[model samples]
Target: MGFQEFLGNERIVTALRGALRTKRVPHALLFTGARGVGKFTLARMFAQAANCERLPDDFCGECATCQRISQLADPQTLLEQGLAERGESADAATVERVPLILQSHPDVWALVPDPVRLKSPVARPMLRVGQLRAVQRAAYFQPMGRRRVFILDGAETMRWDVANVFLKILEEPPGSATLILTAPSPYALLPTIVSRCLQFHFAPLPQAAVEKILKEKTDRKPTEIKLAAQLAEGSPGLAIEMDVEAAAQRRRSALRILERAAQGHGFAQLFSDTSALAKDRDSSFEHQIGVFYGLLTDLLELTSKVKEPVLRNAPLAKELESLAKSVDSAWVLRAIAGFDELYVGARRNLNRQLGLDALAASLAPAPSRASVTHS
Candidate 1:
């Protein structure tokens, strides 16, 4: 996709376009922002624009070069060309897609870590030294295009050794190569790495942009779209990815728990809901903890008067307002702290029902020692 498809970040787009127009693109760039803010998407677009034969400001989406960069032009021909460039003989079926199959484009290479597994004790995938070494080896080659672009998605996932290797490349990069890195924040990487690259900070999209994307991209109800956009915290990718119905149901269940906890009533429904959530193996317990935290968030937002008029749980605005009136900010703050402790405890595979009960109990005026047990 071209830069036209990217919403928000017009300033960044303009600057990058100017650089391209001047034929002065930097050798290394770091696109830093929150998750799903289109850092990787923009990097792909930049690669397309740098290599495209017929575009100045934007890549013609249908051009042979643009389509190849996008991994959609001609898989078999691209595979053959990539194999020939690398001096390898491989069948087309053996080839993977872009980012994974870095050889798909003669002037493009991608380094992306595997999916992070937060639930398990296993570590998140990282950009290893070997991967960096491969890129280093490929750097000296003459590119088929006038410029070569190496896109590194999740640049923060690199370990110290890997990062050092990447630093060396950035220090003396190939004259024809442009390196692009995407991360949640450059602070996660070595200062040396951050120092070497030109930084572009990508902010979250506005609610209007997110709503527009949700409307254009999905068939979710308008109410659901609005709520998802609010919950997305300005990330349009998150807005579209949200399971609206599931989130609504989760919020309702969390509200019930809050009601029971505040009133010091029996937590029968709380236990029942938590048990069901635990049974849904596809849904993480962390999500349930987040829902629990959302109740306190709603209370604090509504009472503080500083938050936007649109609440995450607007459907339960009356209930939240009623709850807000019953307690002062001190109690809400303590309850929020208690839920935060429970949320941290969730990472340790704590008993889901027990954690919910403790969270519910903590909402009372006098929290028991059990409330802090998981903390």
Candidate 2:
């Protein structure tokens, strides 16, 4: 797919397209963004475009090369071709000298993740050291095509030992090869690895950008698109993954807890509910955080756009107004700080329920003042 097919991210599209046009594709690139934000998808398209014969900013998707790439048949053939050489006695020594992976030719071999160490981890799949080794092994051989591209999705999942494994290769990668890695965030990656590659940061998509693509790509209803776009917070990929029914359930749950946080004095109930909520893998702790962020974004939007007293959440908006009467900007800042810390912990494999419970407790005012009032 051409970058033009990608909605939003005009800056990224422009830069990458320009690079392709100039034939100045970087050997290594780091794309950092949230999962389901189209990072992996984009990286694949880039790999295809680099190998494509049609020279332009956009891909002529009708070409033989384009068709093969679209079908992901090119790399497989390359792998198969390399394998034939190694087994054939025609040139056994040269073939044997080639890396085992290259012995079959360059193909996408996602690194095996380290055995799961954390008890409750958000990352189900990770990239392993074995995968990084292949990058080096593949480097000795020349590309069958004009350019060879290796797409590594979930680069941040590289365990600590394997994390810096790519640094040396990235620093001086083969001219004919390109390594494209995508990750939710680069902060967790070793700085040495990060600094060596050309970095591309993907910002969350706007609501309109997401909706347009949904309309273009799928047969979703208008309302479904609206709600999904609203909930995805700018990630079109995740928006597509979103189940309308599940999203509605999340809203219901969030509203329920939000009301509890607003009016209920039983701190124990809030803690218990959130604690239980965090343990739910089906409804991921991250998804719940998205729900919370969505609510806050809605409230902020409402407060700024509307003339009427905050009407969205009667209880919570009312509490917000009351707090606004006395609370300085610092209180809101502190709440964000608490939530941010929880978000950090959640990413670092902290217990979701504990992180959220602590966040709710921190966001809630001390019990004496925040206690439920009787009419």
Candidate 3:
């Protein structure tokens, strides 16, 4: 899609279009935002615009250059097409094992994190030093198009060594090349790296925009689309990819924890529940904590008696309202604070059951101290 068709972040679009028109694009551009907020999409669009032969400030999308760049932008589609060409299986396992980079255009290169050793399905992909070295070698070469565009998707996945290598390339960048790096935030990268580039912060899209995109992209039901849009909180990418049923189940589980805490369940029962939930393979502990936080926010809104409360878990309004009656606003506020602490700790490798148990204890009413009879 052209920049005009792209949803949200109109200001960034205008700035990029102006840059293309002026032929004064930055050598190094950093796009930072939350995941699924259109940073990579905009980066790809900018890359296409930079090299589009027919249009100076925007891509024609039908040109040979734009078509090839589009193919390079969508790594998954390129991977599938390549596998089909080679008569290889395009199954989930095979796709997972393959690295996801596409250089369909001589002037465009899209680099993504790849598994360091490809040992297991759960292994996290990282941007290695070798990958940056290849880009550094290619950046100096004259572009087949107007500009050689190198997109480093998920730049935060780079280890310090890899980032240092990338820093060297940025230090002595080629005039013919433009390097685009995407990350969740500038703070996630090295300060030196942040200082070297023209930074663009992508804010989350509006709920209406997210819903519109969901309608266009997904075959989900209207109810599901609305719920996912609300849960996505302005991220069209997240809304499109969200599993409504899975999210509902997580919210239900979170509500159950609140109910048990309100009923003053014993530590043994709470601990047992926590252990079982920890063992659930359907979702990660981090995701569970997020659901819990969302529920706490809803409860706080309900307890505060907000007019027309906006809730992330809107479908569970009846259940949440009932629970809110059992507890006061102060209780909900304390739970929110406790969950916020647990959420921070979720980043590190902590024992899941212990974390859940701690959250449960925090939610439970404090033990009433009884006066002991004088002996």
Residue 37's C-alpha lDDT in candidate 3? 88
Ten-residue region with minimum lDDT total, candidate 3 = 366-375
Sorted by TM-score (best first), the order is: 3, 2, 1
Q: After the best TM-score superposition of candidate 1, give how far the Cα of residue 293 lies from its true spot, in angstroms.
A: 8.6
lDDT at 142, model 2 = 77
For each candidate, what is the lDDT? 0.72, 0.64, 0.78
Q: Per-residue lDDT of 1-375 in model 2, one digit per residue for the tens?
A: 466677777788788878888989888888998767777667767766766668566666677666666654233454455446445342323422443332122333322232222233333546645557767777656776667777776677676676666777886788888888777677757888888778998988877898997888779999888877776778888888788777767666775565565553567777777766776667756567666665554455454544664332333455445534443444445555766787778667877766776666666656644553433
Candidate 1, RMSD to the unseen true structure? 6.9
| Candidate 3 residue-pair clash tally | 0
TM-score of each: 0.67, 0.75, 0.78
Off by over 4 Å in 2: 72-123, 255-259, 262-264, 297-329, 367-375
Q: Per-residue lDDT for 131-249 in model 3, tens only? A: 67778788999988899999998897788766888998899989989999998778668899989999999987878898898888889898888889877767787777788777777
Q: For model 1, give the 10-residue run with minimal summed lDDT.
A: 90-99
Better of 1 and 2 by TM-score: 2
Clashing pairs in 2: 79-104, 82-103, 82-104, 83-104
